[model samples]
Target: MRIRATVAAVTGALALSALAVPAAQAGEAPTYRESAAAAFAAAHGTSDKAAFSTAAAAEMDITFSNFKIAQAVKVGTTNKVSTTVTYTLTHGADVDIHSEDFATGPYIYRGAFDTPDNMLFGDYAATCTDTSATTATCKGNIDVYPADGELLNAHAGTWKGGALALDYVTGDYADQGGLGTTLVQRYSKLTVNASPEPVVKGKTITVTGKLSRANWETFKYAGYTNQPVKLQFRKKDSSTYTTLKTITSNSTGELKTTVTASVDGYFRWSFAGTTTTPAVNATGDFVDVQ
Candidate 1:
């Protein structure tokens, strides 16, 4: 994969490129082999600041399977999000996955696989443990920093995943895309308020709330519009909640509904979530029926 322009420019100057970027940068992050990474950079061609093309790497014998990234990843406005990735690696029996000259990991990316718009790799390499003679289980990190400008709000939604196999010693590597699909979502919030704290029996009590989520580009939280949200209720002494009804948020993301007051209870708005936003539930608003 061509190192997407954003990251390629940041690391291209240094001999050792993307894979071992930190390791080569005067002791920044750890890398498997700085020299190997440099060689891989040369052989694979990292000059294109626009993208680190994946077109050139010769195919290797290693194959990845059962790849799993999170079903959905929710990132907020200004915090680091860490998630795990797991996959099964099948390679030639003679290949030693643990060899010092070898490095491998799972990465999730956006846009085209061959020339992705963006890509995310773990700060550290995936830990692979042998499960059989020709197979192993690999687990790695999918680290994201909202403050780091690596992603844009427009990038939220569906993304694909794959694995990277590197051999610094031979200056050879392989990037296997299309391993899986996952959702990269914005962090979400839901709020609730019920009025007339104390009411007479059979009185109508109104509940109001709003649904919002992080907007990466603007660095603000904005209303999440026209989404189906559930109004749930629970008795003061009860531990469980029951769904009273499902309501859709307005264009401005406002929610309002009325329910008959029968007894003391708490009310809340719960969002089931969408591909671009995560599920959220408002804190319960309590009211008492006299």
Candidate 2:
């Protein structure tokens, strides 16, 4: 298997609106309901904690910084993945965080939190080590498996993450309520191969390979079909490799193409990558032209 290195930065902006009206106002019920619905949808997995009211959620301040994960995750491998995230939480001026705090932590996941179909993979918990009154460092390993059955294609590509939520005691004397924040997550992997090393100058040289991405469900690499890949060649003692042709992979992630030998040179397959998977280039195979 041929390997390539790729890096991607996942980031998103957090928006918070100030509350102008008082919580006791009866007209604010609709706004609270809408906010509650949105918050509930973004929560990772299922939680017994109640959704935070709009007023309560607005008062809760949470920010995630220095979030990082593995640059390359291999397919068909049980990778021990680690992530670090810094969090700061404050309960505005009127709310006493210590008085109402019951459960507080971060939740990380890959895929759309609201859409079940898009929520292909995830890890809900990471242990937090406190560093200050409202700040802490969170770290943990996420077990990524390969996707099987209905979710086979869902495994490969950039997995979005950085979802952090805080659970607190609410109600009259502090019961249970929580809210969530959003961040970016990305993961990608690739593979390649070549054959028929010796050939005549005028004879057609056949090249073949495969394109795959990591599957978190089964912890394996699965075929990424119908994707375009570039065939390139570098002449003997030459510094640069030029693109020869473009071809697409088949259903099994197989890639194939042909080129006539001109001189002693090297041949390779390159993938530009996708949103979920990182870019990769196969090792060159030297062909001796007679």
Task: For residues 1-290, write the lDDT of model 1, one tens digit per residue.
Answer: 11211223334242332442433345453353333233334433555222123443544568899998889989998888888999999887657789876777777878765445566666666889999998899998777777656679888999898777776555456657789999999999999999888989898999999999998887778988889999999999997999999999998889999999998989999998888898888999889889
Q: State the displacement of the C-alpha of residue 92, model 1, in Å, after optimal TM-score superposition.
A: 2.7
Per-model TM-score, in order, reads: 0.80, 0.54
> Once superposed on the true structure, which residue ranges of model 1 sit more than 4 Å away at CA?
1-56
Q: Judged by lDDT against the true structure, how good is candidate 2?
A: 0.48
Cα lDDT, all candidates? 0.74, 0.48
Residue range with the least summed lDDT across 10 consecutive positions in model 1: 1-10
| Tens-digit lDDT track of model 2 for 149-227 | 2223453454444333444334211112222222222233344444466788788888887877655555566787898
Among the numbered candidates, top TM-score falls to: 1
TM accuracy, model 1? 0.80
